[model samples]
Target: MESETYRGYNVWGHAILQQEAILAPERFAASGTITRNNKLVEASGVLGLFNAEAEAEQAGLAWALAWIDSHG
Candidate 1:
């Protein structure tokens, strides 16, 4: 799990290890998880798909941070 810290929460990125063949073939899916005080607060469901893992991580981090900003 790759992660970033934002507003006292740990925003983590999850990579798709096993992709289903029926989904979009050109993109890879990723999710985000938010942890605060060593506890899980939120988990984003399939936030994005991208051509590269780095891209997915970037997008996931952005989404998680935005969620924190809006909901925190």
Candidate 2:
């Protein structure tokens, strides 16, 4: 079997994800805006002491911006 990964998530269980993207062509396009939980997203992109709530929120926006830099 060919091995590949997308967004760090294994594609094996991603058939549903593929289906979702296919169903919503716009959402699957190269660039699109989508909403997510502030708590979950806040930790990824911001720089600060870990576990800091306010910092996490800022980091999340940074995280998303970083993602855009590469994905765009």
Candidate 3:
């Protein structure tokens, strides 16, 4: 997980590890969350699967910024 402050909101990008089979390659699941005043404002369910942890995290951050741009 990574965190940043944007437009007075606290945003987080999460990368969760995933594996389908024993021999299958590992994957990452993307998700995001936004908060203000230490209160929950919004959270994404799963955004998508990504091959790299950084990619997944960046996707989540992008989603969060977009959400803030429209809603904030």
Best by TM-score: 3
lDDT, candidate 1, 1-72, per-residue tens: 579889899998866754567684556578889999999999889976788777787777888898999997
Worst 10 residues of 3 by lDDT: 57-66
Candidate ordering by TM-score (highest first): 3, 1, 2
How would you order the candidates by lDDT, starting with the best? 3, 1, 2
TM-score of each: 0.79, 0.31, 0.95
Selected candidate, larger TM-score, 1 vs 2: 1
Clashing pairs in 2: 45-59, 45-63, 46-59
lDDT of 3 at 59: 88
The number of clashing residue pairs in model 1 is 0
lDDT of each: 0.81, 0.30, 0.94
Q: Tens digit of lDDT per residue, candidate 3, span 1-41?
A: 88899999999999999999999999999999999999999
lDDT of 2 by residue, 1-72 (tens): 111233432211101111255454421111112234322221131133333333333343444455545654
Model 2 — TM-score against the truth?
0.31
